[model samples]
Target chain A: MSHGLASRAGRISAQIGIVVAIFLFWEVAVQTGMANARVLPPPSLVLPRAVAMLGDPVVLYNLWITSAQVLLAFVLVAPIGIAIGLLLGESDYFGRAFKPFFFFLASVPKSVFLPVFILAFGIGFTQKVAFGMFQAIFVLVISAIAAAESVSSDFLKTARAYGASRRQLYLDIYLPAMLPVIVEGLRLGMIFNITGVLFAEMYVSRAGLGHLVSTWGMSFQMVNLFAGILLAAALSIAVNEALRWYENKVGAWRG
Target chain B: MSMRTAGGNDDRSGWILLLKNPLVLRLACLGMILAFWEIAPRMGWVSPVMLAPLSATVISGVTDFGVFARNLGVTFGSLALALLIALGGGGAVGLLLGSVRPLRTTLLPIMSSIYAVPLVVVYPVFTAWAGIGVESKVLFGGLYGFFPMLLATAAGVRTVDGGYMVAARSMGATRFQMIRHIMLPAALPSIMSGVRIGSAMTAIGVVVAEMMAATAGIGFLITQNRTMFNTAEVYFGVFLVVVLAGTIDWAVSVIERRAGSSYPRKVRTL
Candidate 1:
C-alpha cells in the first residue's frame, strides 16, 4: 500500500482502539462500583441483553413498524414534495409568496405539529406516519426548489438557441441536473423520517422501537434502556452510512 | 396598442398588476384557508374537534394571551441561555479539535455518528438526571446546539485554505496572526451555517423537553389543553411556537448575513 493508504489504515485502527478502550473503562467502572450500576450500566451487561432482546417478538414487531413508517413516508414525501418544488421553481409569483412560509415551517418545532397530527389521525400508526411524512417532506421540497433553480441558465439559453422544444429542454437538461440534489434530499428525508417516526412513538404510541426505549427508561431499567437506545442508534447509523455510500457511488458524475 | 393612452391613468393594467402582486396572492391564500376553517366546522363538513374554527381559535388565543406570553418568556429565556453556552463552549471545543490532526481523525467520526442518534428519545434521561426544571430543558437544548455548532466550527477550521496559510506564513506572520488574519476569515461562513442550524434546533430541544416533563411553558400548556380536548387553546399554543421559531430563524439569518457580508461568497460544490 502507498503511504496514503497506510496512513488511512492507521487512523481507522486508532479510532477502533479508542472506542474499545472507552467500553472497557465503562465496564470496569460499573463492575468496581466506581459508577452506579442502576443509573449507568456497563456495556457487558447491556450488550448481551440487547442481543437477546433483538430476538424478542415485541422488539421485532416494533422494529418492523418503525421501518414501515419510514418507508411509507419516503414514498409519500418524495412525489408531493418534488411536485410542489417544481411548481415553486417554475412560477416566480407563487415562489415569492410560499417559499418564506415553507422556510418558516422548516424551522418550527415539529413537536408542536405532533399533537395536531395525533389528534387528527388518531393516536395510532397513521398519526406517526403523518408526522414522519411532514418531517421529511419540507426537506425534499426546499432542497428540490433550490436544486431546480440552480440548473444553469446558460444551458437553457444554449438549448433554446438550438431550437430545442420546452419538453426536450426539461427532459434532457433540467431533470438530469436536479438528480444529484434530489439524492441529497432523499438522504435527508430518510434521516428525518426516522427521527419523526421515533419522536411520535416516544411521545404517544404504545408500540414501536421508540416506545420500547421509553418504557425501559421510565422503569429504571438502565441496562435494558441503554441497550434499546444503542440498538436504535445502530439502525440509524446503518441507514445513514448506506445512503452516504450510495451517494458517493452515484455522485461521481458530480465530478 | 393603437387604442390605449401611453403614459396616463390606465386602470386596467393597474388592476392586473394588483392581482398579480405576491403579497396579495399570499393574503388571498390565507383568506381562503381562514374561510374554509370557519365554514367547515359550522357546515358540518369537518369535525370541530380536529380543527377549531378561526373565530373561536382567535377568541381563545386572545383570552389566553397572558398565560401564553408567560410560558413563551420561560421557554424563550431557557433557549437563549442554552444557545449562549452552546455557541461559546462548542465553538471553543470545535476550534481545539479542528486544529489538531490526530485528535480530529479519532474523534470527528465519533461525534458525527453520535449526531444521528435520535436525541429526543434521551429526554427522559435528562429528566431523570437533572430533574424536571428549567435546568433540564436548558441542558437538553444545549446538547442539541452543541453538536451542530462544534461540528460546523471544526469543519470550518479544518477546511481553511492552505494557500492562504502559506501566503500569511511567507509574510513572517505568527500563529496568532495567521489565525486572526487568514483562518478565521475563511471559516466565518461555515461557522455561520452552524450557528443558524444550532439556533433553529434550540426551540425544538427546549419545547420537546418541556412537553415531556414540565408543569409550565407553552408545550405544557398545549398538552394540558390537548388532554381536555380544548382544540382552540391547543391551536393557540401551536401558533405561538411557530412564531417563536420563525423569529429565532429570521434573527439568526439576519445576524449571519451582516457578519458575512464583507466576505467573498464561496460557491458550493458537490
Candidate 2:
C-alpha cells in the first residue's frame, strides 16, 4: 500500500481505538459502581433511550419544527446581510453611518429580545423565527460587510475605467470576492440559529428537542434527557462538518 | 503649494462637516421608530396588550431596577468566579498540553467535543449533582468557559515562534524564564481573545443554569416574569442582561486595545 493509504488506515484505527476505549471505560465505571447511572447514565442505557425517542412522532415533529425555524431564520438573515454588506462595502459614507449602530445592536444580548419578540409575534413559530433571526443577522451582516470591504479598490477602479456596468462590476468583482466570507457568516449564523431556536423552545415551546429535554428533565428521566442531549450534540456536529466540507470546496475554487 | 494646503484644510473641514451632518438624521430615525411604536397601538396598528408603550416599560423597569441590580450582582459574581477558575486551570493545562505534541494530539479532540456538547442539556445533571444553587451555576459557567480558554492558550503557545525560544535558550534562559518572558507575552493576544469569548459563554451558562433551576440571578428574574406573564418585567430583566454583557464586552475590547499597544513593535505591526 502507498504511504498515504497506510497513514489513513492508521488514523482510522486510532479513532476506533479511542472510541472503544471510552465506551469500555464508561461501561466499566457503571458495572464497578464507580459512576452512578442515575446522574451519569451509561451509554448502554442512553443509546437505547435515544433510539426510542427517534421512534416517537412527537420528538420527530419537534425536531422538524426546530429545523424549519432554523432554515427560515437563515433565509431571512442571509439576503439582508448580503445586501447591507454590499451597500456598506460600496460606500464610505454608508459604512461610517451604520457601523456604530451595527456594533450597538450586535453587542446587545439577543436573549433579552425574546420577550419583546414573544410579545409582538406571540408564543409560536413567529417568535422563535424572530429570535433566531435576531441572534444570527448581526453576525452575518458584519462578516459580509468586512468581506465586502476587503475587495480591492484597484479592482473596482479598473472595472470602472474599463467601462464596466455597475451590475457587471458587482456580479464579477463583489460576489466572487465576498462568497467565502458569506459562507463563513452562514456557518456562524447556523450556530446562533440553533441556539436561538433551542432557547426559544426551552422558554415556551410545546415541542422540539429543547422541549423533549425539558420534559425529560422535569420528569426526572435522566437517561432520556442524556439521550436527547447526545442527539443534539451529534446533530450540531453533523451540521458543522457539512458546512466545513462546503467551505473547503468553495475555498478551493477561490484558491 | 499654499493653494494645495488650503484644499487639504478644505477636505478635513468637509469630512468633519459630513460627520456632524448625520447626528440629526440618526436621531430622527430613532424618534420615528418610537413614534410609530407609540401611535400604532393608539391607531389600531398593533395590539396595546401585546406591547406596552416605551414610556410604561421604561418606568416599570426603572421601578424594578433594585431587584434587577441584586440579581445582576449574583450573575456577575458567579461569572467572575467562573472566569478565574477557567483561566487559571485551563491556562495551566493548555501550557502543559501545548508543550507535548502527543498529549495535544490525543486530548484536543476530547476537549473540543466537550466544548461542543450542548451544555444546556447537562444543566439538569449539574443541578442534580451539585444541588440547585450558585455553586452549580459557577461550575456550569466555568466548564463552558474552560474549553475556549484551553484551546486559545494552546493555540497561542503553538504559534509562538520557535526562533524566540531558541534564541532565549542560547542566551542561557531557563525554561521558566522562557515561559514567563517569551511565551506569556507572545500569547497574550490569543489569551485575551479567549477570555473575551469565555466571558460571553460564562454569562450564557450562568443565565441558562439560573433559568433551569435557581433561586436568584437575572435569569431567575426573567423566568419569574415569564411565568407571571409580566412582559414588562421580563423585558426589564433582558435589558439588564444586555447591559451587563455590553459592559463586559466593552471592557474586554478596551483592555485588548491597551494590551495590543504594549506588544513588541513587530508583533503590533503584524
Q: How would you encode candidate 2's per-residue C-alpha lDDT over B1-270 as one tens digit per residue?
A: 122222223546764454454443455567888888667766778776566566666787889878888998999898889877777777888888776666666666566655545566667667767887899999988887788888888888888888888889999999999998888888888888887877777777788778767899988888887777676687667777877887888898999889878867465311
TM-score of chain A of 1: 0.89
User: Candidate 1, residues A34-127: lDDT per residue as tens digits?
Assistant: 9888788899888998899889998999999988988888898889998888788778878977888777666666777887886688888888
Chain A TM value for model 2: 0.87
Report clashes for each candidate as comma-separated counts.
0, 0
**Per-residue lDDT of A146 in model 2:** 81
Report DockQ per prediction, comma-separated. 0.60, 0.43
Please provide TM-scores, in order, for all candidate models, with all chains considered together: 0.88, 0.86
DockQ of 1: 0.60
Model 2 per-residue lDDT at A55? 86
True contacts kept of 1: 0.55
Docking class of 1: medium
Model 1, range B125-179, lDDT digits (tens) per residue? 7776777889888998888888899999999999986777787788899989987
In DockQ, how does model 2 score against the reference complex? 0.43
